[model samples]
Target chain A: MTALASDTRASRQPISFALLAQVILIANSFIMLYPVVVMVLSAFKTTGEIFDHPFALPDFTQVGNFTKVLGETEMPTYFMNSILVTGTSVILILVLGTMAGYAVARYESRTNTFILLFFLAGLMLPLKLAVIPLFILLRDLGLLDSRWSLIVTYTAIGLPSAVFIMAGFLRTLPLELEDAARIDGASEPRIMWSVMLPLARPPMAIAAIQNAVPIWNDFFFPLVFIQTDERKTLPQGLTTFMGEYTTDWGMLFAGLTIAAAPITLLYIVLSRQFIQGMTAGAVK
Target chain B: MLVSHKQAPSLKRQLWVAFLVVPPIAFMSLFVVYPILSAFAYAFYDWQGLARGEFVGLKNFREVLFGATMAPVVWNAFLHNVYALIALMVIQNGGGFVLAWLLYKEPFGFRFHRIAVFVPVVLSTIIVGFLWKLFLNPNFGIVNQALYALGLDSWAKPWLGDSSTALGALILANAWHFIGFPTLVYLAGMQRIPPEIIEAARLDGTNEWQLLKNIVWPLVAPSTTILFTLLFIGAFNWFEIPYVMVGLDGSPFGSTDVLGLVFYRTAFGNQSASIQNFGLGSALATLLFLFIVVFASMLTLWLRRREIQF
Candidate 1:
């Protein structure tokens, strides 16, 4: 009887341990998400109601807050600019990063290490270090106040990491596939395009998401380079709603919702891919 | 698909590669490299954007280091960064590691927890700053409300308004924003650990805690090194969180004025001011670059020495 009871106690310990872990995880996750949830709920409330019932759900769902955000702010224009900048940047990064990765991976000259090191140096130079110079150069080129400024900046910024990922991916690809393409009298660029680029869809998708999210969320570039309200991106535009009326939590939250909704929605729909891509970079 | 450059592209193909590559390189050099170089040159010339002064070699460096006012401000910012780094490493990374470890076990309904924790990471830092600004409001903020409910109303101070706690408060918020990335990274690292190793330890009568301390941790050291180094570098060069939360001047006695914020403030001079002191700004930028390089080198050396290969 004593032996049996001891055995049961030992068996119950793992189950209890797992239960403890579950409780901790659930609690941590709730706390992590509580602020955002409050923001979302506040977006549906009036300014008075948001403060009146701080922890409660909005008394009623109101699309009015979002409408107010859209009407009062330059959100639509910012959204379009974000889309244009992020799209162009990602496309350029995909093409150039792939080509650079191909060259670095395939070529084994004294220049290979130097080229890789050149790109790697960027990872060390924080954006602030270059912010001053970039501003002046952009102004000189008449590129300030345009979405193209951000596009070019984002491309340069995104290149090093994109190349890093693509290089790792390209190295993993089998040599035989390219060999056959070469044997068929396909030119080098043709082989890269027809043979390797398609095979690189996984890493490309990863790089695209990794590049797009931050570019979409960037405020500093638009804050400095973009001088006018009409050229503002979502993040930069959201700050317009913050001048002393930060107490009007409802409208502010609504603006935040407008700014954050797309990314959050995409995160929900494609979380597995998001997690996969993020983890791939971390693990590598 | 490795190939030699000797299997070189034809002239037309070379032209295509050149077309694709040269534009980006030129763009990078023009926007990134030129500005940096110009900033360096500006450091020597004592110009105030209008009248160009003769080159005063190392004068700016001497002023930046020994000048009473800016020197103290720079030192204070550096100290704040260190405080932020310690807080983030302990609170954010440590909490994240625990969560990742829990999720790795994959208890029933673990997927929901993983997704929820990571959700805030995708949101913009601006949004995060604004969100926390509201939540920490002493009057109607939920934090204060919760404190009042618990009869601890005295404890609920104006979080962002107070200089001493303002930087700390933003540190927590910044940690919240970035915690997910490190969590996911650690989780991924933990996943790569061979399951049989755990099974072997378990069969040897090892408890879960013992198994973790002995078998799991040593192998995850590489990820830890990467996480520690990256977070250190990120925290050392911190800007956006404090900038958006505390404003450009690092307000309420300038408690949160990290090097990046100071540099930005000098360059652009905020909305209230019109002075664009390009010389001082570039000098600040140069100082910031030097600071980061020195800090990163020391950190990398420390981390690399400890990085264990399993």
Candidate 2:
């Protein structure tokens, strides 16, 4: 009886330790969520109310701040521009990257290895340093101040990682599928498109999400390359808008909330895939 | 009778491979490789925006490194970047490792904790910057409010306004935004450890602390190396946070200035300087590039030597 009692006590110790860990994690998560939650909530409050009752729940009837942000500002145009740029860049990266990744993964040669290393070297090249010459190059090409410049630059920047991820993923798929497809008289492109591309979807999604977030949120390139207010992406627009409306706390909060909404909603909806995709690149 | 088989790929397959590979290579080389090389070339020339100036050999470099007026700003920004590196290494990565270990134990609500922790990472840094700017507002900010509510009113101050606390505040905000990245990476590393080895260690009378210190940490060295390399590179390239939270000048007496901001301000003048200096900017950019390359290589080599093969 004493032995059984001791066994139960020993088991209870670990359970208690786990429970303590749970408490710590929950508290830390609250700290993580606090600022974001406050931002979202403050979007609905008047500036005076925000200053008066910063922590209290606002009366739900006042959503004029959000309306003002969307209706009065150029936010909707910025949103469209962001969507267009990010979507187009992501598509270009995935298509070109998958093609290159497939070639490198399928062909085993010294040249292919060299090509792989070339792309991998880009992972650490500090491309931000190239901004000056890139400016010159774009100007020389008459591509300055165009959204196409951002799209093209984003695609170039995103390609290395996308190719890296796609190549790693393609190498894992069994070779027999390709062989079988080849034996069935399917061309190499046909095999790649019909057989391999389908298998490559998960990694494609991972690479897309990984690259898409940065492209959508990128402010540096837009700040440098974009000249006009109408062409500004969300981050640049928000920065400019905030500069003009720095004292209008309610509108600033609403503007921030609008800027963060799409990606936040996507993250909440696909948090699992998002986490898995991000961690997948890190682990390998 | 054995059928004759061609081992090497046919000409059609070669064309197909070229078709697959050529476009990305061309695009990357044209945009990425060419621009970087040209930037290096431009560092030596005394060119302003579009006009080709005299070929001044290493004059721009000398001025950027040793000139009377610009050198102090350059050195100050470099030191701030070094501080960012140390702070992130100690606070962000260190905290991430601890949280990863806790999450690895699969405590109650681990899934929720995992998802919630990474929430800030997905948001734009501009938004994160603005959010924190509001939260650290002196009059109506929640940080000061909470401090006062807890009777620690003396501890609260204007976080972004004061020079002494500005860089530290920016570092804290950066760490908060990125802690999720290292946590998830380290958690993945910890999950890769074989369970039976842990069981065997436990049976051999090792305490949890001992196991973690001896077995778990060594196995997670890959994740550590990755995090360190990334943090090191990111430190040198720090810009958006300071640019948004402060300004291009890295305001409040330039306490929060970073190398990236220095380069930006030099290239595209702000309140301080109205005229753009392209040659000096290229020199600064080249210096940044070289610093990242050399330091990252050395760090990777050192960290790679420490990785234990299990």
Candidate 3:
């Protein structure tokens, strides 16, 4: 169905007008990329140089800011904490959400519909609204300043969407596989663990990426629950860095770059996966 | 024995279901449900530090909604959130549609444009906020610097410093950060349109505008429903951007104040005042949550029904 009508009309438009549209897109891409590039460049310049020529190409050899940020600050510690917390949260979310999603998708229980809706409700109402009691509850439990505070909160926050994505995906898998496994004398848990779970890798990755990014980037939970310096994640820790070096432009930009680098690099490499993961919910 | 053989697996399935859903359900009940429920409970009590002092009934809710001191600030913050919501829906989502339409028509640089538009979206909100804050700095920021360079010096003012332009500046920064989300959503929607339908429309001598309006816009409804629901929630829960850029006080005389900031300041008082009042904060949180859930669900249902009609 090659559409001659639409193509002819598209071609009939003036070439210059079409060129203008292309240029606008290119210009937009430039605009989107430009600010971040300038920030990276500013990270290489001294405070004085930044004030003088903010846009000039900086000498790449001046790695002083990076060394100072990495050495003097707890940025590395924050990165480690972020990784640990985000990893644990994503794993928990994937496990719990998958089990629940599988149940809703495959099982013929009377409560499946209600159970699926229960998880779906979490998607609409944000967890931040519960901060008042959450703070009190965390402090009472003596988990206020621990990494577990973030881990638990994040798992709870992420479970709904993870469940949604998984259930939607699992329903599309043929029931014959499960039936075959059952006929082969595979135990219920064994079937799920061996056959279904492995096949669920794509949605699991989507769930992992979706949850990991937010947990890694979360500042509010750390700001609320984790009061100690050792427990702060990158986003909150970056704020601490900013507050400490208010006058040092190069160092601040360096800190920003450090905070942004991991995800940006990961995204650049796995951009298709990232896009698919984030917009997964919308499509479904 | 034969009946038992058939019943055994059914019983086993029940156990499996319990194992699968119980822990996650319990986990959610403990963390998400408990806190939300406790928020409602706390709304009725008075607090001293972390401890509940007395049962205050509707006092806290009254103070949050209608008190002489808190009412004005709360409403003001509420209005700012609404303004941001409307601005973002119009600017960010609207711009996204235009971009998606352009890309759908012109295949040149399709791959690059798709990836590039979404780059900022996946970045940390904290980074986006800090980057924009730095960009909008009065003297040395690139925004003003670029304006000056382009001989638009008269247009460059202290964007965040001036109260009048402060909220608008934050909204623009937000739009810049998230415009790609709607772009991707709308693009996906536009791509799903069958080419034959478009061809049939074109054969009738319909122009691009008519095609977009009559054909594309209506079909983008599903995306619209999702994006609208998300934007509404994001706007109302808008915290990180204003908090990072303008600071907790919503400074420059509180022009950028939002409900989240007010709730934060109220729940756990800031540097200026340290008198924490959990009661009033819970009341405020309860009201905000209820408002969001009720209205957003209604809006979604309405949009969904409209989608069916379209």
Candidate 4:
């Protein structure tokens, strides 16, 4: 009887410890998400109500703030610009990076190895350090204040990691397929395009998401290169909007929600893919 | 027919390879590699905007390092970057490590907790900065209100308004924004550990604390190296949060000034002024780049030496 009692006591200790851990984990997650919850809740409240009962649930669901931000500000335009820049840049990055990654993975040559090393070196080069020269370069090319400038810059900045990821993914693919395609008299381009490209789609998606997020979120380049209000990306536009509407807390919150909503919703929907893509780069 | 086709295809393949590779390489060289090299050259010439002036031969470096006008700003920004590095390492990465350990146990709702913690990471820094700014607002912000409600009103000062707490607040916000990254990475590292080794340690009557300390911690050394190196680089590279939240001047008496902001202001000027000195900006950039490279390499090397292999 004493032995059984001691066994129960020993077992009880780990269970109690696990319960403690669960409480801590839940509390930590709550703290992690509290600010985001506050933002969403405050967005639905009026300025008066927010101040009056900051912690309470909104008295009513209010779409008025969203309407005001979308209708009144240049927010829609900013969103369009962000989409145009990020979409074009991501497409170009995936295409070019995949090609480069294929070359590095399949072509066994000293030159190919050297090129891979060169691209890898770019991973360490903080583009912020080269902003001055890039600014001058863009100005000289007559590309300043143009969305194309951002597209090009983002593509260049994003390529290194994209290439690295694509190459790593491609290396994992069975070479037998490519070899068999070649034996069947398929041209190298055809093999790559039809055989390899389809298999590379998963990694392509990962690279696309990885590259797209930063470009969509980028404010630094737009702040420097873009001058016109219409040309501004969402992040840059949000900052300018905040500066102008510093006093209008309700409207500012609404504007922030507008800027954040699409990505936030996308993250919620495709969170598994997002998390996998993000962690894959580091883990591999 | 097959023999003739083989010769033609081999030549075509080389052309195809060139077509595939050259465009990205040329584009990267023109935009990335060329600019970096020119930045090195631009650091030596006393230039404003685009027109190059006479070669100043490290005069810009001298001004950035020791000149009465810019030295304090430079040093202050560098110090703040260091402070941010230390704070993020302790609070953000340290918190991430703890959370990873707990999650590794497969507690209830672990998946929900993982997803929730990582949600902020996908949001833009602009959104994060503005959201936090509103939350920390003294007059009507939730933080102050919550403090008052909890009867801790004495602790509810202006979080971002005062200089003493401004940087700290920014650090906390920054940590909040990125904690998920390290958490997931550490979790990945922890998952790589073999279950048999852990089960064996448990069979010897080791408690959770002992097993974690003796077995898990050493195995996750690679994650530690990766996280710390990234944190170090990111600390120096920080701009967007401070830029969006506090403005480029690192407001509240420049308490949140960082090297990235200083480089921006020096090169492009701010709302108050329009002094575009390319030489000094490039010099600052060069110094920052060199510091990051040297220290990061050293840290990585040291950490890698300590990493344990299973």
Candidate 5:
């Protein structure tokens, strides 16, 4: 793949053009990253200093903002709620999507094609369009104003893309692997579990990253459904905090940091997977 | 079928397939499909608060489509969405093609640059919106501050507060947040173009521009299709960015309003805005859904058939 990517003829551009191109790419990266860096740095600065020097590096030793956000506020509750809701939804999506995708991939039938299309349809039309009835449905189920409402909605929302990704990847694997497992007398579920699924890690990661990022960061459903502060996710909770602490730049930036840090750290650490996972659809 | 497993292996396989597929599809039916269908149904009824009052038979659609109060707002917001879609296609996707071209050339620190480009895409839209709102603040924002330092004080203004600039600023923010996506996707498409084709083209004396025009562009048609379809869907469904940056009301006289925000405010009723009109809101939602599905599907098929020509 590396050799293919770095084509020999492709590198034959003039040295001056390559230098100019590298400079432009570096500048673009700077433009992309500079503002986020400012947000993170502002979290560690004093409110007065943030106003005075918006671009200056903050004093790293000043742990006051972090402590205040963590201890003196509802940040922890929102954090936990985001984790619970996103974690639960992703788990359900992966499990259900994989099972459903396995069925659609291994079983060749008219029903399977229809099922795949049904799920694929969800990918194009966002669930947010149906929020009005969804809220009513949750109310009827006595799940509104609760994390369960968010969990179910996100699971449903994430499944279509997950199933699409999973099924597409599963179809690319050779049929002989499944035949070998069947000849070994493995049950259908066992063959899927031990053989097919292990090979499915790439798609699972892609689907997980695809779903989890949005689920963790989603504000709309939580904004409408979970009106109670106790059930509020990070994105929505951050807004309420932003309003209350509008003048307190230090705490505001700290709140933003807390909401953003986990995903940012994970992306930086596992960037290969994140990029591959998020952009997997376009490549196909 | 379950009982006849010993007599019929295919029937047994069918049972396994049902077991595997039913639970998830049922879950989706209960949550995603049912609610959406209900939302479409709600568009046909006159609603008194949450309950359906009577079958109004497109009266709500009339009010939403042609009523003096909503018609202008909805179309204006929709026009803004179109503007955003066009602007993003040009600035973000077009810029991305150039960036991908550069990266495809394998520039210095290209690997690090690839990761850097995607960092903003991973951040929440809310965070991106708010961060930009602060950056565009009139008095102390670095954007204005930098302008002043450069002795170009005329360029300084409240980017979000100004009616003329608010929607453009939001589009720019959206582009910033998502530009990495198109860049990488295009890069992936470019990498898939076998090197031998490029070598042959270079031997034919095809200049860089000619190579891009004649060889790479057509080959990357698939990525273009996916990106354009997604951009259309995303543009029409845009909510979070404007909602976060401008407010639920697409403020400064609604310069930044879009269908997603209008749908939310209508269905849920903002305290400062209109009261809840679930019927009318559902009409807008249903229309938006169908509009997206129809155009996106058509675009995909059209681009797909065009791809075969390459």
Candidate 6:
């Protein structure tokens, strides 16, 4: 009877330790979420109310920030451009990256090795290093101000990491599945699409989220490639908002809140997969 | 010999491979390779808008290497990168590793601690930048508010404005945002170590300290090498955060003028000095490329030596 109680006490100690640890973690998470929460609340506060009592509960009197953000600026246009650019770029990267990754993983040929190195080399080469000549090239193509130009640049940039992650994932997948598919009247493309890609979800999801986060947050590419206000994406749009209203902290925070919402919400929902995917990509 | 007999299958496979590889190759060559080569070509000529001048040979490279204005900018950028590297390798990486070590033993509440600290990792750099900007704002920012509340009003200064603190401020913000990444990576790496190894050490009268020093650290070396290399790349490509916080000129006294910012200013900014320096800009970019490529190659070599492939 003493031993039983002792066993329960011992277990309870670890549980109590765990509970304390959780409180600390919760407090830390609140610190992490503080700025995000502040921005979200800022988006709902009136300009006057924001400064009059910055930390107070935002007045339910007005939800004016969103209306102003949507109405007063080219934010809608920027949002559409962002979607088009990110969507098209991600598709191209996935398709091309998958094929390239598969070919590199499957074939043990010298040419395949060279191709892998060719793309992998770009992984270390910073995009800023190419900005000088890129500008000249785009100008010559008369694509400097165009949305598609940035899309093209983004696709190229996204491909290297995409290929690396996909290749790693492909290598780990059992080869027997492909061999069987090939034996069972499946062509290579059909095999990849039907058999391999469907199973490559773990890495693909990793690649997508990894690639998506950067593309969504990217400032440098759009900064250089797209000069026109109408063609700008969210980062550039936010910068424009900052330029016009540097002193308007409330509006600036509101704009930032809009920009941060989607990615943060997505991370909250998909964090487990996100972390797993990220670590998998990094280790590979 | 068997595949030679199956001509239809071989031809179809080849065709499919070609189809898959061609579009990406073409797209890459057009935007990536072509632009890079054009930058190389521009380095050999003097172009003052609309491709105006004769071949300058190595003059642009000479000016960038030997000229008065160009040398300091390059030095400043290199120094900035080194400072950032030190901060990331020391403060962020060190802090993260320590935290990870402490949290490794699933002592009640481990899950919450992991999730809380890692939230910063998922945020966009732009968002992180703006978030920190607001937090550090001199007037209405919470930082000042806290300082004043604690009766340390004189302790607060304009974080992004003062040249002395601007770079350091940016570094702190960056470290906060990215430290979680390496922590998680290290944690994942440590988790992969066989439990028996750790248990064996403990059973052999090894304390927690000895177990960690002998068993865990050695096992995590490969991951450490990879993390360091990646952090090096990230440091070298320091952009977005500085750009958002400090703008194109890297304000105050150009304290935050990283290589990325320098390249952007030279290539695209609407400054009179920047307007006619395409050749010089290309040369500078070429030099920056060589730096990163060489750095990456060296890291890969170092990584190969350290990698204990399990």
Q: What are the Cα lDDT values of the candidates?
A: 0.79, 0.88, 0.88, 0.88, 0.88, 0.76
Tell the DockQ for candidate 6. Answer: 0.47
The positional error of residue A240 in candidate 5, measured at the CA in angstroms, is 0.9
* Candidate 6 lDDT over residue span B1-310, tens digit each: 1222124436656767777667777777777777777777788888776464889899888887777988788788889999999988987777677667656776556676677677778776877888788788887776776788789989989988998999999999998787778878888888888889887886686755667777787788877887888888788888889988887788878888988777767666545454646777788878777777788779878876865656
Point out where model 3 deviates above 4 Å: A1-17, B1-10, B308-310
When summed lDDT is taken over every stretch of 10 residues in candidate 6 chain B, the lowest stretch is B1-10
Question: Candidate 6 clash total?
Answer: 2
Weakest ten-residue segment in model 2 chain B by summed lDDT: B1-10
DockQ of each: 0.55, 0.66, 0.58, 0.65, 0.53, 0.47
By DockQ, highest first, what's the ranking? 2, 4, 3, 1, 5, 6
Candidate 2 lDDT for residue B147: 91
Docking class of 3: medium
- Structural similarity to truth (TM-score) of each candidate: 0.92, 0.95, 0.95, 0.96, 0.93, 0.89
Model 2 C-alpha lDDT per residue in residues B1-310, reported as the tens digit of each score: 2211125777877888899899999999999999989998888888766665988989999999999999999999999999999999988899899899999988778889999899998988999888888888887889998898899989999989999899999999998899999999999999988989888998997767898899998889999998999899999999999998888889889899999999998888887577788899999999888888898989988988878877
lDDT of 5: 0.88
Q: Candidate 3 lDDT, tens digit per residue, A4-75?
A: 976865787647557777987898889788888998999999999988898899999999999999998999
Model 1 Cα lDDT, one tens digit per residue, A72-121 = 66778878887888899999888878777777775444556866786786
True contacts kept of 3: 0.70
Interface RMSD of each: 2.9, 2.2, 2.5, 2.5, 3.4, 3.1
lDDT of 5 by residue, B34-78 (tens): 988898899999888888789989888888789999999999999
lDDT of 3 at B113: 88
lDDT of 1 at A187: 82
- Candidate 5, residue B299: the lDDT equals 86
User: Which candidate, 1 or 5, has the higher DockQ?
Assistant: 1
Candidate 1 docking category? medium
Looking at model 3, the pairs that clash are none
